[model samples]
Target: MAQFLNKLIPTALAIGTGISLIDSSIYNVDGGQRAVIFDRIAGVKEKVVGEGTHFIIPWLQKPFIFDVRSTPKNIKSETGSKDLQTVNISLRVLFKPEIDKLPWIYSKLGMDYDERVLPSVGNEVLKSVVAQYDAGELITQREAVSREIREALTKRSKEFNLLLDDVSITHLSFSQDFTTAIESKQVAQQEAERSKYIVLKNEQEKKAAIIRAEGESEAAKLIIQAMASGPGFIELRRIEASKEIAETLAKSGKVTYMPNTGNVLMNMNASGK
Candidate 1:
């Protein structure tokens, strides 16, 4: 019985060891995940392991899993514009490792490949693209600038076995001096416009005054000529003035009497007077 027990113990121990080795060797590349094998003697393998259960030899080979999912990263940089103005820029990049290049990425950058490469390359692309545009252009042509950055960053990331799903500029700001200068410029423009308007208004007023004076002078000349011809015009003007005054008094709800004796008198006893 002791002999049988000793043999059974060794067999069970061997079986347990094998099970443990199998468990360690088997790895699952879950959804949105990929794996690369690293060999103890041969280094990283070139073949990428797809999703599902994959096996690797126990200590001789190890699996590195990577999430092949789009990730968002933010990068901020302070750079100079083409006009030599200082600008602060923020960038957002969505990126993932190329599935086919997983082996290379694992070999070179490990699991944190985006961390190792994105910020440096993102800042590089942002600085380069932003430096080509003036501060004002960055504001006016924001979409174009973002497109350029996306193109440049996409090109740059390819060299590191990365795929850029999207790239965009999230925020931008200039130095306080630049901001103040812009405000001052806008104020100056507005003041200039107001000055133009005022000048035009003054010119129009001057023209109106000249026209009024000319009209009055012409009327006086005609009146003098009429008076030289006869006193008829003066008589007619006095009658018109008297008629106008009578009409005005009538509209005022007052009673007045005009006499041919060259005098006027009001009715002292009127209703509502």
Candidate 2:
């Protein structure tokens, strides 16, 4: 009876050990076949499935899951321009690691890609490009500045095993004194433009007035010349004036008498002679 109990105990112990081994070392990678990596290996390579359970080696081969989605990095920097004016700039960058280059990225930049590569490259390129522009140009041509920074960052990303999706400048701020000065200069420029337009308008109006005066003078001279050319012209003009006066009197329904001018002139001449 003691020998039978000893054999049963050994069998129970062996079964328990096998179950522990299977549980610890063998894992299903959400596929048909199970993956069994020994407890002494360095790493395991397998494709992970979505919405399914995955497994890894129990004690040796660790599985590090990385999200294949896009991520963003916010980069803030304070820099100076060529004119020694300080500018504050903030940028948001969207990026992702290439899935095919995951192993290289893990080996080279590790998991903290944002912490290690983003700020460094972002700051360096920002400073380098900003140093070449003055404060006024920086304020006016900010889009160009952002493009240059994006280009520089894109070029530098190859070293860090990153792909730059997009880069945008979110905000830019200048010193209080600089901003006040810029505002004042812009206002002065606008005022100057307004004054120039007013002056041009006045000049144009003056030219028109002069043209009108010249036309009136030319008309008066032509009338005088026509009168001097013929003696009957004055008599004709007086007859026309009499007709206009008669018409006006007729319209007003008033009676007008026409005096005999020839007899009055002959009596005045006889008395004088």
Per-residue error (Å), model 1, residue 177: 1.2
lDDT per residue, candidate 1, 135-204, as tens digits? 9999999999999999999999999989999888889999999999999999999999999999999999
lDDT of 2 at 4: 98
- Single out the weakest 10-residue window by summed lDDT for candidate 1: 263-272
Model 2: how far residue 133 lies from native, Å: 1.3
RMSD to truth, every model:
5.7, 10.8
Model 2 agreement with the true structure over 138-210: per-residue lDDT tens digits: 8799999999989998888767767889999999888999999989999999999999999999999999999
Listed in order, each prediction's TM-score against the native is 0.70, 0.67
Error of 1 at 172 (Å): 1.3
Clash pairs of candidate 2? none
Task: Please report the candidate that would top TM-score against the real structure.
Answer: 1
